[model samples]
Target chain A: MELYLIIILVLMILGSIYSLNASDLLSAVISYGIVGFGLVIAFLLLQAPDLAIVQVVVEVATLIIMIAAIKNTQSKIPKMEFKPKIAIYYAITLIAALVFILIFDRATGCLSQFGADTMRMAQPYIDGAQHTKSANLVTGVVFDYRAYDTLGEATVLFTAVIGVLTILRIKGKKEK
Target chain B: MIIYILCFILFLVGLYGVVSKRNLIKIIIGIAIMEYSINLFFIMIGYIEGGTAPIITKGFEHSKFVDPLPQAMILTSIVIGLATTALLLAVAIRLYQKYGTFDINKIKDLKG
Candidate 1:
Protein backbone atom coordinates (compact mmCIF):
# COMPACT_ATOMS: atom_id res chain seq x y z
CA MET A 1 0.00 0.00 0.00
CA GLU A 2 2.79 2.38 0.89
CA LEU A 3 4.54 1.50 -2.33
CA TYR A 4 1.42 2.30 -4.26
CA LEU A 5 1.22 5.62 -2.48
CA ILE A 6 4.85 6.39 -3.27
CA ILE A 7 4.31 5.61 -6.91
CA ILE A 8 1.26 7.84 -7.10
CA LEU A 9 3.09 10.63 -5.31
CA VAL A 10 5.95 10.35 -7.78
CA LEU A 11 3.56 10.61 -10.68
CA MET A 12 1.89 13.63 -9.09
CA ILE A 13 5.24 15.34 -8.60
CA LEU A 14 6.26 14.74 -12.19
CA GLY A 15 2.92 15.95 -13.46
CA SER A 16 3.17 19.13 -11.45
CA ILE A 17 6.74 19.83 -12.58
CA TYR A 18 5.73 19.36 -16.19
CA SER A 19 2.63 21.45 -15.78
CA LEU A 20 4.63 24.26 -14.32
CA ASN A 21 7.21 24.21 -17.12
CA ALA A 22 4.92 23.45 -20.06
CA SER A 23 4.90 26.16 -22.73
CA ASP A 24 1.28 25.66 -23.76
CA LEU A 25 -1.27 26.95 -21.32
CA LEU A 26 -3.84 24.31 -22.30
CA SER A 27 -1.41 21.46 -21.84
CA ALA A 28 -0.35 22.91 -18.54
CA VAL A 29 -3.92 22.94 -17.27
CA ILE A 30 -4.49 19.40 -18.52
CA SER A 31 -1.34 18.23 -16.77
CA TYR A 32 -2.53 19.90 -13.60
CA GLY A 33 -5.52 17.56 -13.78
CA ILE A 34 -3.10 14.66 -13.38
CA VAL A 35 -2.16 15.92 -9.93
CA GLY A 36 -5.79 16.33 -8.92
CA PHE A 37 -6.87 12.92 -10.13
CA GLY A 38 -3.82 11.26 -8.62
CA LEU A 39 -4.99 12.66 -5.32
CA VAL A 40 -8.31 10.89 -5.82
CA ILE A 41 -6.50 7.56 -6.17
CA ALA A 42 -4.48 8.31 -3.07
CA PHE A 43 -7.63 9.03 -1.15
CA LEU A 44 -9.09 5.67 -2.18
CA LEU A 45 -5.93 3.85 -1.19
CA LEU A 46 -6.15 5.49 2.21
CA GLN A 47 -9.70 4.15 2.56
CA ALA A 48 -11.49 7.40 2.06
CA PRO A 49 -14.06 6.54 -0.60
CA ASP A 50 -16.15 9.54 0.31
CA LEU A 51 -13.28 11.86 -0.51
CA ALA A 52 -12.44 9.97 -3.67
CA ILE A 53 -15.95 10.46 -4.96
CA VAL A 54 -16.01 14.11 -4.09
CA GLN A 55 -12.57 14.66 -5.53
CA VAL A 56 -13.33 13.03 -8.86
CA VAL A 57 -16.51 15.01 -9.34
CA VAL A 58 -14.90 18.27 -8.37
CA GLU A 59 -11.86 17.58 -10.52
CA VAL A 60 -13.96 17.10 -13.62
CA ALA A 61 -16.02 20.19 -12.98
CA THR A 62 -12.90 22.28 -12.32
CA LEU A 63 -11.28 21.01 -15.49
CA ILE A 64 -14.31 21.98 -17.53
CA ILE A 65 -14.45 25.46 -16.02
CA MET A 66 -10.72 26.04 -16.51
CA ILE A 67 -10.81 24.78 -20.08
CA ALA A 68 -13.71 27.07 -20.79
CA ALA A 69 -11.82 29.97 -19.29
CA ILE A 70 -8.77 29.37 -21.51
CA LYS A 71 -10.97 29.16 -24.59
CA ASN A 72 -11.69 32.86 -24.56
CA THR A 73 -8.02 33.74 -24.01
CA GLN A 74 -5.54 33.11 -26.77
CA SER A 75 -3.11 34.88 -29.07
CA LYS A 76 -3.67 38.22 -27.40
CA ILE A 77 -0.44 39.28 -25.73
CA PRO A 78 2.90 39.18 -27.41
CA LYS A 79 4.69 36.23 -25.84
CA MET A 80 6.77 37.61 -23.04
CA GLU A 81 10.42 36.79 -23.52
CA PHE A 82 12.33 35.64 -20.52
CA LYS A 83 15.13 37.99 -19.73
CA PRO A 84 18.24 36.02 -18.64
CA LYS A 85 18.19 37.84 -15.32
CA ILE A 86 14.62 36.74 -14.50
CA ALA A 87 15.49 33.15 -15.29
CA ILE A 88 18.48 33.38 -12.99
CA TYR A 89 16.32 35.02 -10.38
CA TYR A 90 13.77 32.23 -10.61
CA ALA A 91 16.51 29.62 -10.36
CA ILE A 92 17.79 31.25 -7.22
CA THR A 93 14.31 31.45 -5.76
CA LEU A 94 13.63 27.83 -6.59
CA ILE A 95 16.79 26.65 -4.89
CA ALA A 96 16.11 28.90 -1.94
CA ALA A 97 12.58 27.53 -1.65
CA LEU A 98 13.87 23.98 -1.84
CA VAL A 99 16.36 24.65 0.93
CA PHE A 100 13.77 26.44 3.01
CA ILE A 101 11.25 23.62 2.92
CA LEU A 102 13.89 21.03 3.75
CA ILE A 103 15.23 23.02 6.67
CA PHE A 104 11.71 23.81 7.78
CA ASP A 105 10.70 20.16 7.70
CA ARG A 106 13.75 19.09 9.63
CA ALA A 107 13.35 21.78 12.24
CA THR A 108 9.75 20.93 12.91
CA GLY A 109 10.36 17.16 12.74
CA CYS A 110 7.07 16.64 14.57
CA LEU A 111 5.08 14.77 11.99
CA SER A 112 4.95 11.04 12.62
CA GLN A 113 5.66 8.27 10.15
CA PHE A 114 3.02 7.51 7.59
CA GLY A 115 0.17 5.30 8.87
CA ALA A 116 1.21 5.75 12.48
CA ASP A 117 -1.76 6.77 14.58
CA THR A 118 -0.53 8.94 17.41
CA MET A 119 -3.71 10.93 17.63
CA ARG A 120 -4.65 12.28 21.04
CA MET A 121 -7.36 14.61 19.84
CA ALA A 122 -9.59 12.46 17.66
CA GLN A 123 -10.44 9.79 20.22
CA PRO A 124 -13.49 11.60 21.54
CA TYR A 125 -14.70 12.33 18.04
CA ILE A 126 -14.54 8.60 17.39
CA ASP A 127 -15.65 7.19 20.74
CA GLY A 128 -18.43 9.69 21.17
CA ALA A 129 -19.83 9.18 17.68
CA GLN A 130 -22.35 6.56 18.75
CA HIS A 131 -24.53 9.27 20.22
CA THR A 132 -24.72 10.91 16.81
CA LYS A 133 -26.38 7.70 15.50
CA SER A 134 -24.78 8.01 12.09
CA ALA A 135 -23.29 4.98 10.38
CA ASN A 136 -20.72 7.05 8.58
CA LEU A 137 -18.26 8.60 11.00
CA VAL A 138 -16.92 11.25 8.65
CA THR A 139 -20.31 12.51 7.65
CA GLY A 140 -21.41 12.55 11.24
CA VAL A 141 -18.33 14.50 12.16
CA VAL A 142 -18.90 17.03 9.40
CA PHE A 143 -22.65 17.57 9.59
CA ASP A 144 -23.19 16.92 13.29
CA TYR A 145 -20.30 17.40 15.71
CA ARG A 146 -18.87 20.19 13.62
CA ALA A 147 -21.94 21.60 12.01
CA TYR A 148 -20.75 25.11 12.57
CA ASP A 149 -17.55 24.43 10.69
CA THR A 150 -19.55 23.13 7.77
CA LEU A 151 -21.72 26.21 7.97
CA GLY A 152 -18.58 28.34 7.76
CA GLU A 153 -17.56 26.46 4.65
CA ALA A 154 -20.97 27.11 3.16
CA THR A 155 -20.61 30.79 3.90
CA VAL A 156 -17.25 30.83 2.11
CA LEU A 157 -18.77 29.13 -0.92
CA PHE A 158 -21.59 31.65 -0.88
CA THR A 159 -19.12 34.49 -0.71
CA ALA A 160 -17.20 33.02 -3.62
CA VAL A 161 -20.37 32.78 -5.70
CA ILE A 162 -21.20 36.40 -4.98
CA GLY A 163 -17.68 37.49 -5.83
CA VAL A 164 -17.62 35.58 -9.10
CA LEU A 165 -21.00 36.93 -10.10
CA THR A 166 -19.85 40.43 -9.31
CA ILE A 167 -16.65 40.08 -11.29
CA LEU A 168 -18.25 38.41 -14.29
CA ARG A 169 -21.10 40.91 -14.49
CA ILE A 170 -21.89 42.26 -17.94
CA LYS A 171 -21.34 45.69 -16.54
CA GLY A 172 -19.71 46.78 -13.30
CA LYS A 173 -21.60 49.98 -12.28
CA LYS A 174 -23.39 52.43 -14.55
CA GLU A 175 -21.27 55.00 -16.35
CA LYS A 176 -20.06 57.73 -14.01
CA MET B 1 10.03 11.20 6.08
CA ILE B 2 10.69 11.06 2.38
CA ILE B 3 6.99 11.26 1.67
CA TYR B 4 6.56 14.36 3.76
CA ILE B 5 9.63 15.94 2.20
CA LEU B 6 8.38 15.17 -1.28
CA CYS B 7 5.03 16.71 -0.45
CA PHE B 8 6.76 19.87 0.71
CA ILE B 9 8.74 19.93 -2.50
CA LEU B 10 5.49 19.69 -4.40
CA PHE B 11 4.35 22.68 -2.39
CA LEU B 12 7.52 24.56 -3.32
CA VAL B 13 6.96 23.76 -6.95
CA GLY B 14 3.62 25.49 -6.67
CA LEU B 15 5.14 28.37 -4.76
CA TYR B 16 7.78 28.72 -7.45
CA GLY B 17 5.17 28.98 -10.14
CA VAL B 18 3.10 31.47 -8.16
CA VAL B 19 6.03 33.75 -7.40
CA SER B 20 8.08 33.47 -10.60
CA LYS B 21 5.51 33.11 -13.35
CA ARG B 22 4.23 36.27 -15.02
CA ASN B 23 1.25 34.79 -16.82
CA LEU B 24 -2.05 35.10 -15.00
CA ILE B 25 -3.23 31.63 -15.99
CA LYS B 26 0.01 30.06 -14.87
CA ILE B 27 -0.30 31.84 -11.57
CA ILE B 28 -3.77 30.42 -11.12
CA ILE B 29 -2.50 26.97 -12.00
CA GLY B 30 0.24 27.45 -9.45
CA ILE B 31 -2.28 28.28 -6.79
CA ALA B 32 -4.20 25.14 -7.71
CA ILE B 33 -1.04 23.08 -7.40
CA MET B 34 -0.34 24.51 -3.98
CA GLU B 35 -3.84 23.62 -2.91
CA TYR B 36 -3.45 20.05 -4.20
CA SER B 37 -0.25 19.53 -2.26
CA ILE B 38 -1.94 20.72 0.89
CA ASN B 39 -5.09 18.60 0.54
CA LEU B 40 -3.00 15.53 -0.13
CA PHE B 41 -0.79 16.24 2.86
CA PHE B 42 -3.74 16.58 5.19
CA ILE B 43 -5.39 13.37 3.98
CA MET B 44 -2.14 11.49 4.23
CA ILE B 45 -1.73 12.49 7.84
CA GLY B 46 -4.87 10.71 9.00
CA TYR B 47 -4.05 7.42 7.32
CA ILE B 48 -3.77 4.34 9.54
CA GLU B 49 -2.17 1.28 8.04
CA GLY B 50 -4.72 -1.38 7.15
CA GLY B 51 -7.60 0.58 8.58
CA THR B 52 -10.99 0.46 6.93
CA ALA B 53 -13.20 3.39 6.13
CA PRO B 54 -14.97 4.87 9.13
CA ILE B 55 -18.43 3.65 8.22
CA ILE B 56 -20.05 1.23 10.66
CA THR B 57 -21.89 -1.65 9.11
CA LYS B 58 -24.05 -4.45 10.49
CA GLY B 59 -21.23 -6.99 10.27
CA PHE B 60 -18.19 -4.99 11.28
CA GLU B 61 -19.16 -2.66 14.07
CA HIS B 62 -15.77 -2.66 15.80
CA SER B 63 -13.42 -2.35 12.87
CA LYS B 64 -10.55 0.04 13.23
CA PHE B 65 -10.89 3.12 11.10
CA VAL B 66 -8.58 5.87 10.09
CA ASP B 67 -8.98 9.28 11.68
CA PRO B 68 -12.30 10.81 10.69
CA LEU B 69 -11.70 14.32 11.93
CA PRO B 70 -9.14 15.17 9.30
CA GLN B 71 -11.26 13.53 6.67
CA ALA B 72 -14.21 15.64 7.68
CA MET B 73 -12.12 18.80 7.78
CA ILE B 74 -10.54 17.99 4.45
CA LEU B 75 -13.94 17.43 2.90
CA THR B 76 -14.86 21.00 3.67
CA SER B 77 -11.41 22.20 2.69
CA ILE B 78 -11.81 20.59 -0.69
CA VAL B 79 -15.03 22.47 -1.33
CA ILE B 80 -13.43 25.64 -0.08
CA GLY B 81 -10.53 25.12 -2.46
CA LEU B 82 -12.88 24.67 -5.36
CA ALA B 83 -14.67 27.84 -4.43
CA THR B 84 -11.42 29.75 -4.20
CA THR B 85 -10.13 28.38 -7.49
CA ALA B 86 -13.36 29.28 -9.22
CA LEU B 87 -13.24 32.75 -7.81
CA LEU B 88 -9.62 33.18 -8.87
CA LEU B 89 -10.30 31.93 -12.38
CA ALA B 90 -13.24 34.26 -12.68
CA VAL B 91 -11.06 37.13 -11.60
CA ALA B 92 -8.48 36.01 -14.12
CA ILE B 93 -11.02 36.08 -16.90
CA ARG B 94 -12.16 39.53 -15.93
CA LEU B 95 -8.58 40.77 -15.92
CA TYR B 96 -7.96 39.32 -19.34
CA GLN B 97 -11.08 40.94 -20.70
CA LYS B 98 -10.06 44.35 -19.46
CA TYR B 99 -6.34 44.14 -20.31
CA GLY B 100 -6.68 42.05 -23.48
CA THR B 101 -3.64 40.07 -22.36
CA PHE B 102 -2.80 37.57 -19.62
CA ASP B 103 0.59 39.04 -18.98
CA ILE B 104 0.84 40.79 -15.63
CA ASN B 105 3.62 43.14 -16.66
CA LYS B 106 1.54 44.38 -19.57
CA ILE B 107 -1.48 44.99 -17.35
CA LYS B 108 0.32 47.56 -15.23
CA ASP B 109 -2.23 50.38 -15.58
CA LEU B 110 -4.40 48.85 -12.83
CA LYS B 111 -1.58 49.22 -10.32
CA GLY B 112 -3.44 51.85 -8.37
Candidate 2:
Protein backbone atom coordinates (compact mmCIF):
# COMPACT_ATOMS: atom_id res chain seq x y z
CA MET A 1 0.00 0.00 0.00
CA GLU A 2 2.80 2.40 0.79
CA LEU A 3 4.42 1.65 -2.56
CA TYR A 4 1.18 2.34 -4.37
CA LEU A 5 0.70 5.56 -2.41
CA ILE A 6 4.23 6.72 -3.25
CA ILE A 7 3.61 6.17 -6.94
CA ILE A 8 0.28 7.97 -6.79
CA LEU A 9 1.71 10.90 -4.87
CA VAL A 10 4.54 11.27 -7.36
CA LEU A 11 2.09 11.13 -10.24
CA MET A 12 -0.04 13.78 -8.59
CA ILE A 13 2.97 16.06 -8.28
CA LEU A 14 3.72 15.50 -11.94
CA GLY A 15 0.14 16.35 -12.81
CA SER A 16 0.26 19.54 -10.79
CA ILE A 17 3.48 20.59 -12.46
CA TYR A 18 2.09 19.85 -15.90
CA SER A 19 -1.06 21.81 -15.24
CA LEU A 20 0.94 24.78 -14.11
CA ASN A 21 3.25 24.63 -17.14
CA ALA A 22 0.77 23.63 -19.85
CA SER A 23 0.14 25.99 -22.70
CA ASP A 24 -3.41 24.84 -23.32
CA LEU A 25 -5.95 25.78 -20.67
CA LEU A 26 -8.22 22.81 -21.33
CA SER A 27 -5.42 20.30 -20.96
CA ALA A 28 -4.21 22.12 -17.89
CA VAL A 29 -7.63 21.76 -16.37
CA ILE A 30 -7.65 18.10 -17.33
CA SER A 31 -4.34 17.52 -15.56
CA TYR A 32 -5.74 19.28 -12.54
CA GLY A 33 -8.39 16.57 -12.54
CA ILE A 34 -5.54 14.10 -12.26
CA VAL A 35 -4.49 15.71 -8.99
CA GLY A 36 -8.05 15.60 -7.69
CA PHE A 37 -8.70 12.00 -8.72
CA GLY A 38 -5.38 11.03 -7.19
CA LEU A 39 -6.59 12.67 -4.03
CA VAL A 40 -9.78 10.56 -4.04
CA ILE A 41 -7.66 7.44 -4.25
CA ALA A 42 -5.43 8.63 -1.44
CA PHE A 43 -8.50 9.13 0.73
CA LEU A 44 -9.62 5.59 0.00
CA LEU A 45 -6.16 4.27 0.78
CA LEU A 46 -6.20 6.14 4.07
CA GLN A 47 -9.41 4.32 5.08
CA ALA A 48 -11.58 7.34 4.68
CA PRO A 49 -14.25 6.03 2.34
CA ASP A 50 -16.56 8.88 3.11
CA LEU A 51 -13.96 11.42 2.04
CA ALA A 52 -13.25 9.47 -1.10
CA ILE A 53 -16.91 9.59 -2.07
CA VAL A 54 -17.29 13.30 -1.38
CA GLN A 55 -14.01 14.12 -3.10
CA VAL A 56 -14.88 12.14 -6.22
CA VAL A 57 -18.22 13.91 -6.56
CA VAL A 58 -16.76 17.35 -5.95
CA GLU A 59 -13.83 16.72 -8.30
CA VAL A 60 -16.15 15.93 -11.21
CA ALA A 61 -18.25 19.02 -10.62
CA THR A 62 -15.16 21.19 -10.28
CA LEU A 63 -13.62 19.85 -13.49
CA ILE A 64 -16.81 20.44 -15.45
CA ILE A 65 -17.10 23.98 -14.13
CA MET A 66 -13.44 24.74 -14.85
CA ILE A 67 -13.69 23.36 -18.37
CA ALA A 68 -16.79 25.44 -18.93
CA ALA A 69 -15.00 28.52 -17.70
CA ILE A 70 -12.10 28.00 -20.08
CA LYS A 71 -14.55 27.32 -22.92
CA ASN A 72 -16.22 30.66 -22.26
CA THR A 73 -13.05 32.72 -22.46
CA GLN A 74 -9.94 31.28 -24.10
CA SER A 75 -8.23 27.92 -24.18
CA LYS A 76 -4.72 29.16 -24.91
CA ILE A 77 -2.60 30.27 -22.03
CA PRO A 78 -0.85 33.55 -22.62
CA LYS A 79 2.90 33.36 -22.96
CA MET A 80 4.53 33.99 -19.60
CA GLU A 81 6.50 37.20 -19.56
CA PHE A 82 10.14 36.61 -18.77
CA LYS A 83 11.32 39.15 -16.28
CA PRO A 84 13.94 39.67 -13.59
CA LYS A 85 11.07 40.03 -11.10
CA ILE A 86 9.86 36.53 -11.92
CA ALA A 87 13.30 35.07 -11.27
CA ILE A 88 13.35 36.85 -7.94
CA TYR A 89 9.88 35.53 -7.19
CA TYR A 90 11.05 31.98 -7.90
CA ALA A 91 14.08 32.41 -5.66
CA ILE A 92 11.91 33.77 -2.87
CA THR A 93 9.42 30.94 -3.15
CA LEU A 94 12.11 28.30 -3.12
CA ILE A 95 13.79 29.84 -0.11
CA ALA A 96 10.52 30.19 1.71
CA ALA A 97 9.63 26.59 1.04
CA LEU A 98 12.96 25.40 2.41
CA VAL A 99 12.64 27.55 5.49
CA PHE A 100 9.09 26.42 6.07
CA ILE A 101 9.93 22.73 5.80
CA LEU A 102 12.84 23.07 8.17
CA ILE A 103 10.75 24.86 10.75
CA PHE A 104 7.91 22.36 10.35
CA ASP A 105 10.22 19.37 10.70
CA ARG A 106 11.78 20.72 13.86
CA ALA A 107 8.45 21.74 15.35
CA THR A 108 6.81 18.38 14.73
CA GLY A 109 9.58 16.31 16.30
CA CYS A 110 7.46 15.85 19.41
CA LEU A 111 4.54 14.66 17.29
CA SER A 112 3.70 10.99 17.39
CA GLN A 113 4.54 8.82 14.43
CA PHE A 114 1.83 8.26 11.83
CA GLY A 115 -0.97 5.72 12.43
CA ALA A 116 -0.73 6.21 16.17
CA ASP A 117 -3.33 8.84 16.89
CA THR A 118 -3.26 9.93 20.52
CA MET A 119 -7.03 10.20 20.22
CA ARG A 120 -6.91 13.16 22.57
CA MET A 121 -10.23 14.43 21.32
CA ALA A 122 -11.43 11.56 19.14
CA GLN A 123 -11.67 9.03 22.00
CA PRO A 124 -14.83 10.65 23.25
CA TYR A 125 -16.34 10.53 19.77
CA ILE A 126 -15.47 6.89 19.43
CA ASP A 127 -16.94 6.05 22.85
CA GLY A 128 -20.08 8.17 22.64
CA ALA A 129 -20.82 7.39 18.99
CA GLN A 130 -22.46 4.05 19.82
CA HIS A 131 -25.28 5.85 21.60
CA THR A 132 -26.07 7.78 18.39
CA LYS A 133 -26.93 4.38 16.86
CA SER A 134 -25.62 5.28 13.42
CA ALA A 135 -23.81 2.44 11.72
CA ASN A 136 -21.65 4.85 9.78
CA LEU A 137 -19.60 6.74 12.31
CA VAL A 138 -18.74 9.48 9.84
CA THR A 139 -22.35 10.17 9.05
CA GLY A 140 -23.16 10.14 12.73
CA VAL A 141 -20.35 12.58 13.42
CA VAL A 142 -21.43 14.94 10.67
CA PHE A 143 -25.15 14.89 11.31
CA ASP A 144 -25.55 14.17 15.01
CA TYR A 145 -22.35 15.16 16.75
CA ARG A 146 -21.51 18.21 14.68
CA ALA A 147 -24.86 19.52 13.53
CA TYR A 148 -23.78 23.13 13.85
CA ASP A 149 -20.79 22.50 11.64
CA THR A 150 -23.10 21.11 9.00
CA LEU A 151 -25.30 24.15 9.27
CA GLY A 152 -22.29 26.40 8.78
CA GLU A 153 -21.23 24.39 5.76
CA ALA A 154 -24.70 24.75 4.23
CA THR A 155 -24.69 28.47 4.90
CA VAL A 156 -21.31 28.81 3.21
CA LEU A 157 -22.52 26.92 0.17
CA PHE A 158 -25.64 29.07 -0.02
CA THR A 159 -23.59 32.24 0.27
CA ALA A 160 -21.21 31.06 -2.45
CA VAL A 161 -24.09 30.29 -4.82
CA ILE A 162 -25.57 33.69 -4.21
CA GLY A 163 -22.19 35.27 -4.76
CA VAL A 164 -21.71 33.41 -8.03
CA LEU A 165 -25.14 34.42 -9.30
CA THR A 166 -24.54 38.00 -8.32
CA ILE A 167 -21.18 38.11 -10.02
CA LEU A 168 -22.52 36.52 -13.19
CA ARG A 169 -25.58 38.72 -13.34
CA ILE A 170 -26.25 40.41 -16.68
CA LYS A 171 -27.29 43.65 -15.02
CA GLY A 172 -25.82 45.11 -11.87
CA LYS A 173 -27.13 48.69 -12.10
CA LYS A 174 -30.58 50.13 -12.71
CA GLU A 175 -31.24 52.18 -15.84
CA LYS A 176 -30.98 55.92 -15.32
CA MET B 1 6.14 11.44 8.54
CA ILE B 2 8.09 11.40 5.30
CA ILE B 3 4.79 11.15 3.46
CA TYR B 4 3.68 14.28 5.22
CA ILE B 5 6.66 16.10 3.78
CA LEU B 6 5.73 14.93 0.32
CA CYS B 7 2.24 16.25 0.83
CA PHE B 8 3.61 19.60 1.84
CA ILE B 9 5.72 19.64 -1.30
CA LEU B 10 2.53 19.28 -3.30
CA PHE B 11 1.23 22.30 -1.49
CA LEU B 12 4.39 24.21 -2.40
CA VAL B 13 3.76 23.38 -6.03
CA GLY B 14 0.36 24.95 -5.76
CA LEU B 15 1.70 27.99 -4.00
CA TYR B 16 4.30 28.44 -6.73
CA GLY B 17 1.60 28.35 -9.38
CA VAL B 18 -0.53 30.93 -7.59
CA VAL B 19 2.44 33.22 -7.16
CA SER B 20 3.82 32.93 -10.69
CA LYS B 21 0.94 32.23 -13.06
CA ARG B 22 -0.50 35.10 -15.07
CA ASN B 23 -3.70 33.31 -16.05
CA LEU B 24 -6.71 33.40 -13.76
CA ILE B 25 -7.80 29.82 -14.43
CA LYS B 26 -4.32 28.47 -13.71
CA ILE B 27 -4.36 30.31 -10.39
CA ILE B 28 -7.67 28.68 -9.63
CA ILE B 29 -6.23 25.29 -10.48
CA GLY B 30 -3.35 26.01 -8.16
CA ILE B 31 -5.77 26.93 -5.39
CA ALA B 32 -7.61 23.65 -5.92
CA ILE B 33 -4.35 21.75 -5.75
CA MET B 34 -3.53 23.41 -2.48
CA GLU B 35 -6.93 22.48 -1.11
CA TYR B 36 -6.43 18.85 -2.10
CA SER B 37 -3.09 18.65 -0.33
CA ILE B 38 -4.57 20.04 2.88
CA ASN B 39 -7.46 17.60 2.80
CA LEU B 40 -5.18 14.68 2.13
CA PHE B 41 -2.92 15.72 4.97
CA PHE B 42 -5.82 15.88 7.38
CA ILE B 43 -7.06 12.42 6.45
CA MET B 44 -3.56 11.01 6.57
CA ILE B 45 -3.10 12.46 10.03
CA GLY B 46 -6.11 10.55 11.27
CA TYR B 47 -5.13 7.27 9.69
CA ILE B 48 -4.39 4.15 11.75
CA GLU B 49 -2.13 1.45 10.40
CA GLY B 50 -4.41 -1.49 11.24
CA GLY B 51 -7.67 0.24 11.97
CA THR B 52 -10.76 -0.35 9.91
CA ALA B 53 -13.30 2.22 8.87
CA PRO B 54 -14.95 4.17 11.66
CA ILE B 55 -18.32 2.53 11.11
CA ILE B 56 -19.53 0.61 14.15
CA THR B 57 -21.27 -2.52 13.02
CA LYS B 58 -22.99 -5.46 14.73
CA GLY B 59 -19.91 -7.36 15.89
CA PHE B 60 -17.14 -4.81 15.28
CA GLU B 61 -18.48 -2.35 17.80
CA HIS B 62 -15.37 -2.70 19.95
CA SER B 63 -12.90 -2.55 17.09
CA LYS B 64 -10.41 0.22 16.51
CA PHE B 65 -11.72 3.16 14.51
CA VAL B 66 -9.68 5.76 12.76
CA ASP B 67 -10.23 9.25 14.08
CA PRO B 68 -13.69 10.45 13.10
CA LEU B 69 -13.17 14.06 14.06
CA PRO B 70 -10.84 14.94 11.20
CA GLN B 71 -13.01 13.13 8.69
CA ALA B 72 -15.97 15.25 9.69
CA MET B 73 -13.91 18.40 9.56
CA ILE B 74 -12.52 17.56 6.14
CA LEU B 75 -16.03 16.74 4.88
CA THR B 76 -17.06 20.32 5.44
CA SER B 77 -13.79 21.64 4.05
CA ILE B 78 -14.33 19.75 0.79
CA VAL B 79 -17.76 21.31 0.24
CA ILE B 80 -16.42 24.74 1.08
CA GLY B 81 -13.60 24.19 -1.43
CA LEU B 82 -16.17 23.50 -4.15
CA ALA B 83 -17.97 26.71 -3.33
CA THR B 84 -14.68 28.58 -3.36
CA THR B 85 -13.79 27.12 -6.74
CA ALA B 86 -17.19 28.01 -8.20
CA LEU B 87 -17.07 31.57 -6.97
CA LEU B 88 -13.55 31.91 -8.33
CA LEU B 89 -14.55 30.62 -11.75
CA ALA B 90 -17.51 32.98 -11.88
CA VAL B 91 -15.22 35.83 -11.05
CA ALA B 92 -12.76 34.68 -13.71
CA ILE B 93 -15.56 34.58 -16.28
CA ARG B 94 -16.71 38.02 -15.28
CA LEU B 95 -13.19 39.31 -15.46
CA TYR B 96 -12.87 37.88 -18.96
CA GLN B 97 -16.16 39.44 -20.06
CA LYS B 98 -15.10 42.82 -18.84
CA TYR B 99 -11.48 42.79 -19.95
CA GLY B 100 -11.74 40.60 -23.07
CA THR B 101 -8.74 38.56 -21.95
CA PHE B 102 -7.72 36.11 -19.20
CA ASP B 103 -4.25 37.53 -18.79
CA ILE B 104 -3.95 39.55 -15.60
CA ASN B 105 -0.96 41.45 -17.00
CA LYS B 106 -3.21 43.12 -19.57
CA ILE B 107 -5.59 44.42 -16.94
CA LYS B 108 -3.17 47.14 -15.90
CA ASP B 109 -5.61 49.89 -15.01
CA LEU B 110 -7.20 47.93 -12.17
CA LYS B 111 -3.83 47.28 -10.58
CA GLY B 112 -3.43 50.61 -8.85
- Model 2 agreement with the true structure over B45-106: per-residue lDDT tens digits: 88887788898778988888888889999999999999999999999998888888888888
Runs of candidate 2 exceeding 4 Å displacement: A81-92, B110-112
Q: Model 2 Cα displacement at B29 (Å)? A: 1.0
| lDDT per residue (tens digit) for residues A1-176 in model 1 | 98888899899989988887787888888999999999999999989999999999889988988888889677333455779888888788868987897796886488788899766877787787789988899999999999999999999999999999988989658776
| lDDT for A113 (candidate 2) | 83
Output DockQ, candidate 2.
Answer: 0.82
Name the docking class for model 1. medium
Indicate the TM-score of model 2.
0.93
Task: State the lDDT at A70 in candidate 2.
Answer: 79
The most accurate candidate by DockQ is 2
